[model samples]
Target: MDTQADRLAGAATGCPYPFHRPAPLEQPKELADLRAEPVVKVLLPSGDQAWMVTRYADVRALLADPRISRNLNRPGAARISKTNKLFQDPRMDPDPPEHTRIRRLVMKALTATRVERMRPRVQQIADELVADLVRQGPPADLNETLAYPLPIRVVCELLGVPVQDQQRFRVWTSSFKSISGSSEQNRLALDNYMRELIETKRKSPADDLISAMIAARDEDDGRLSEYELHWWSRLLVLVGYETTAVQIGGAIAMMLAHPDQFALVQEDPDLMKSAVEEILRWKLVGSSVTMLRYVTEDVEVGGVTIPAGSSIIPAADSANQDESVFEHPEVFDVTRKDNIHLTFSAGTHFCAGAALGRVELEVVLATLLRELPNLRLTVPVERIRRDEKHLLESFLEIPVTW
Candidate 1:
């Protein structure tokens, strides 16, 4: 009924929120002031304005708030990116009973138990990658050799994608996550590939997520639709591969950046769990900002009235950096016991693959520490190139030596 422009017609124009970093590993300077206000009107990259919620409590609360919806394809919703359709995809904004039903069936197939069973295979993958890295000699691009491949293979196996086809899948997923002009083309290619792969799985079923979903789609009750299966497959590969891949690269770089903290983990490999948690809490894994949630009704957040049909960004990165919730929030401590961060988000839309990501990170960290204790960055942390084009904030290359 109401447009975002109509809702903000008389409101004061706010400062442009800087989405790009002044430097790699540095939060945008505007974040400090924005977090103080908690809720403020700001301009987005797409030039549409929306409310940004940055305080930890407000963000955590708003994530679970029923008044907000992730269906950003709505007419009045703020666009996060001009070129990327990742958010605009209908699969990104599944409504009601459909969302509930799909999540239920997907969760059953992607349980913590199932992920735990994958640990040994995941660890073996890490070991093989590391051994290959050693043989390739010093000064290797860790992101290319290990970070990206480990999770790509893991996701391929989990989805029953053939080993020979993983490299193409990797290229397609990379394109799917990119914010560049070619992203749309790559997204369509990946979509077509998933559709064909689903058909292949339908004929020759296997013990994998795709096969499981196909069976669900064929049930007499018909719980999952053909549309849902294809989109779900694409979504899983994107989240399962790219998100974890970026986090793995970020986690290692974080440890390498803080030598003292890195030493603590190295001295006591038992601290890998805490280290991974701290990394998730500290690093802005996926993007400079989180996804947008369209307000379904007039809601008061942080003492500000956001009208219905408005767009709001719950800044999870800024939330994790809030000083009130975390004592000395800027300091990266590996052994911090009380660490609870919203990196994976909260409430009903919390990341489904969070457990699997954690396992991959833990296995990577522990295996590296044991096998290549001398692993260190070949270049300065600030010198590491950050991907400016992709929605995912990952390093262009993580050069390392053991």
Candidate 2:
């Protein structure tokens, strides 16, 4: 296709930074608009009219619709510029054929078995972080101490990157995550870091991701180029922690606030799986952006017509809250059945790190409850500050005390 439709160009009135916050967790303004009209055509800043499908059923159908393309490389693509900060990803820019290749390469390392095997290590990391928290006492910053660091540490291990350089790694990630930095500068900083790291890993074999990538590159040609390997490692590190950084805090916040649910998870560790799913659902993430989709053709959707060349947002957060598909969608019940929440998304583009994320959340959050049996927020629930302005919505500082 010569043209790429940008969703950012469409006509719609929603939160500009939907990834951060919107009309509270249980209530999204779009839900009501959707009920009134399953597909609402709205104008975007770029002057394009796009369809915003709100119903759970409709959203899922649209996501699975083969006509809904994810390629962002089209001529008119609605680029989520790094400055946008609306998404932790801009790599969503590639159209299929090209996109499929990068995605397949990513699938190699972010495999289900690798994530599953790392559970024990993740569990240990969680314990170690919390142990330090205990030493520091209540009124602790979970965001700085746990939410952010845990994922960084895990990804570092997965990439075979050294943890001894924790300060540098933290600074690297912080720059990318910074709301104030220029996108080019952050990208440059990240590129430089990855290049240096890759060179180091190449010269001397290590036990982390870079070393593994080098081995994998040698084994498979055209799969990972030197530049691709560099970017891949950087992308892994960046995407690896973006959502998870929020989830780590969001998971604990969801459970702690819902004592009954938290108690159940604490009592039966097996329930950790369900608890994590529920957390993924209830997370107050994604108010403005979603897994962006481009229409490959004109498709009739839920009594509405979506024309070809249109860009769309697969609002997983809204999809997760659809009451028709989910009974009591607003309730924070961990026992919800047959939950196939699309938080990690569905279809061919399903999150490569879905399994890894699940293991990390389950092991870490479960351990927190078990070790700090009396854990409670040091600050008022309502008073807790969330980075509602960024793509990853999370507590800026979840102060906790036991």
Candidate 3:
């Protein structure tokens, strides 16, 4: 097991540290090379060494492993970046029983039936936004026109947040994503804002998610603590706003870039579901690693023994590109069958908003294609600017003409 040649080979390949953690729109080539290896030691931006697991089977196993933990409070847990460490939310970073309880309560408020009920509103929002984009004329930034506003409005309405407060919230969220800002300061400000909103909801409860959670806390024998309530709301707003926005932008970019696939979907409206799934699979908009999970005990993956307390990052991007699991993995096939991409992740922490995000994507894509059949990128694909400091693989401006 102590083969010098193996270690030498790994060292020779050059550890692809950092891998442009904040702004890699395309999957890095080094990740593809690492997928061939059992586990590759990578140096993170925080200067911590972690074992990067890239293969689909191994990544799925890593996410589901009971010994692996998502708890950032644990000593020596691997951190993705200093910003992540500073902006950690208990609702997102906690390991189960706590995670289970919070997730269960949140799920009650975001049930599949509840999310489906919002489809008409989602359609209306999409229609209105498209109408505005049309009124504004061509060479408009879709990121501002449709991508950002759609999810922001949906989440704001769902949480009873005033639509007027969106600009302030955007500033707060942007700081959380920025590499230069004081993450703690931004987090504290956002936290205080959420707490105040919670108080407002408590005084005059409405029919929104925040009101429902407040009722659950006040009437359910303290099932949710004050701290838990605040963090849960923050988590919901962050996920609902950021991830969906990035995804909407990424999906539109991909569809526009791939004219053939775009034509296929436009020709056959029935392929909408498959098309959305393919966009999630093809786009590497999310982080290469879902979130760092620390190894609790010495574990063997691909014949490599990773010691306890070591950081393990499951490469969702690579898993989506795994040749073993997907045919013509590089091709963006809207009609690809047997799609089981791990973009929303898997296991205990699988994204709770998956259904809602799917609905937004489907509605936006369908509406855009139907309403603006001539929609095309205003700039070359290479000219589209990326937010180099933003955590998500996001576009600064997705200018489009219809």
Which candidate comes out best when scored by TM-score?
1
Q: What are the clash counts of all predictions, listed in order?
A: 0, 18, 0
Judged by lDDT, which candidate is best? 1
Task: Rank the candidate models, highest lDDT first.
Answer: 1, 3, 2
* Residue pairs in clash, model 3: none
Overall local distance difference test of candidate 3: 0.79
- Residues 1-402, model 2: lDDT tens digits: 211122332243533323223422344554444444465554433344345665777777776777887765565655444344434345444445666676676676566777777888988888999899888887777888888889988888898766786546656665564444336765777778778888888899865656766766324335666766776787678777766887787777767778888888777888878878888876455443446667888887677677778777666766777777889887888887788888777767777778888888887787788788998876556676766445454457777878
CA-only RMSD, every prediction:
4.1, 5.1, 3.0
**What is the Cα-based lDDT of residue 9 in candidate 1?**
32
lDDT by residue for model 3 over 74-105, one digit each (tens)?
67765666555444554454777767777777
TM-score of each: 0.92, 0.86, 0.92
- Candidate 2 versus truth, CA RMSD in Å, comes to 5.1
Error of 1 at 341 (Å): 0.7
Lowest lDDT block of 10, candidate 1: 2-11
Give the Cα-based TM-score of candidate 3 against the true structure: 0.92
Evaluated at residue 243, the lDDT of candidate 2 is 68
What's the lDDT for residue 237 in model 3? 80
lDDT at 86, model 1: 71
